[model samples]
Target: MKKYVRGLAIVGVLTLAVAACGSKPAENTAGGDANKDFKACMVSDSGGFDDKSFNQTSYEGFQAAVKAKGLTPVKAESKSDNDYPTNMTAMVAAKCNVIVAVGFKLEDATDKAAKANPSIKFAIVDSAPATPIENVKPLSFNTAQASFQAGYLAAGMSKSGKVGTFGGLKIPPVTIFMDGFAEGVRYYNKQKSKNVQVLGWDDAKQAGLFAGGFEDKAKGQNTAQNLITQGADIIFPVAGPSGLGGLQAAKASNGKVNAIWVDTDGCVSAAEYCSVLISSVKKGMDVAVQDAITSVVDNKFDNKQFIGTLENGGTSLAPFHEFDSKVPAELKTELDTIKADLIAGKITLESKAQPKAS
Candidate 1:
């Protein structure tokens, strides 16, 4: 059977079976509608909930799960990394039963919070603690797998024979996308005997351009423009909301350039740039978030890490939306075959950033 692929809008489906482990009922809260009083809380990274990328998608899943279980929902938005600990503390004080801290940046804070409160269950997205804690669950995604497909798509579609990708920061989660994209371009070149150049990232050197943070749109725009000036027609920005600037750069190019978004479907999250986007590399953060919440509601929460991958419907390529008709059918078929190959272990990736097996 083929693996499942999900976009940002279809997050309502609770299809995170591959990522979540089977849970055993909790000793203390096993019966009598635990969900009614169960509190699901979340603390966002610096990007806040409307980022149209990571935070937004995760928040959507969190909200969906809370609504489905009729549980109380509470959220805290961090203005910067400094706020992680404070916000986490606030969630704890709110008497939350389960707390999820979004982003790798919050790993330290989440760890501290989890350690300080043994009674509360905690989960952190995109990061794992240095030392494992019995109460903290890790929610991670192997985006490199899906990003490889996206890289190949960009290479196959690039009219200039040059495609580029940049990141918000030089972190594992961010660079995982870059590494796969660069490798995919190399793979395409080897397969087709075509020298399609990739700018912004070099997997061999493990070096590339970065926007320094996930919030600066102008910086994202400038960085993308730099790639464009180098003759790249397809730009993939792995930055969060900052990536919207890359789309703005593409839009300014008129018919000369296009882009691929990261984390969520650009067509739905950043619709203004839909005309310029070929597709998006989507992470099923929402699905995983809901699954985590559900486990709590069922009184079966565990600390095992949840790693999303192409095989599990966790990470996938978004539909080609406005470019659906424009994307050659042959290319689409090739992508499907590539996805199957990856899922079946016929193909493998070299990204060092892939989540460690649990």
Candidate 2:
């Protein structure tokens, strides 16, 4: 009855019955009889294959595509910023049909390697080059839409009537979640005539809390404790693996706090925190990665940008696992309406981090 957890290097496997739990289908890579020799490869950022966040999610998708299509898989994991270029170059040298570069920091490396090896198709996660690269497909998400829902959920569930959020950095990708989260709290206040306070972010000022980096769990834990002390009963962290600190902080809160997660479904990816997980604002890195690999393998590869929106199933709110019944049915219904409204343009989230349509 516990949540699923995937180990480092090895990928995910579901524990519960998918239908009963109301989770979305895992990324599909099953078709394509052509291009059996097509090789799919990836060059990871320093978090490498075990980040369980951006890097791991993308690799999982690429690996799934390799397995389903019977295509060969190749990978090189970077251990530092300096390793990005070297790892990418190695994949290119290996003649990988599609080379995926994980992380926004890999922009230069992906562009450089893509330009040098023009024949090979490329996919870049969480970034698009400053200049148009006709051979590189950019896979990015409008995570704000989903984070908004998490914010609203936190606001409704908070015993203290306050919630907090912090980021790995103040970058657009991270701040986008904060902006939408603040907006969601504000929206909840407006709708319910509640004065729910959102600590750590001010969307109008475009600034607030940030832990500075993705690797420091101590910073994340400290940030969570500080926010909890401020009467915020819930905290959302966009700090990749560092978000785990929020979990530890919540578990130590003497039943006064809960944590919302980002990137992937933390309920599954970080089962150790499942007892306190409110939910996750997921970016479909796995699907996008698999799509990129399959496109090349299926001989339909294009350099078009793939923007993940809630409507397109690219970004979403994960189910309340341990907290399923704890979340009121009425709040769940409202979230469904908000999702449809956002997709229908009846409700809109404004953030520059939103990936543009092709």
TM-score of 2: 0.88
TM-score of each: 0.90, 0.88
The lDDT per prediction is 0.81, 0.76
- Tens digit per residue, CA lDDT, model 1, 1-358: 1111111111111111111122211222212333757777777787767889998899888877877787666666677676666667766776788887778887777778889999998877787666678898788899998999999999999999999999988888888999889888888998899999999999888999999888899999999999999999999999887888999999999989999998999899889899999999999988998898788778798888888999898999999998999989998998999999999989899988888855
Displacement of residue 335 (Cα, Å) in model 1 is: 0.6
Task: Name the top TM-score candidate.
Answer: 1
* Residue 266, candidate 1: alpha-carbon lDDT: 84
lDDT of 2: 0.76
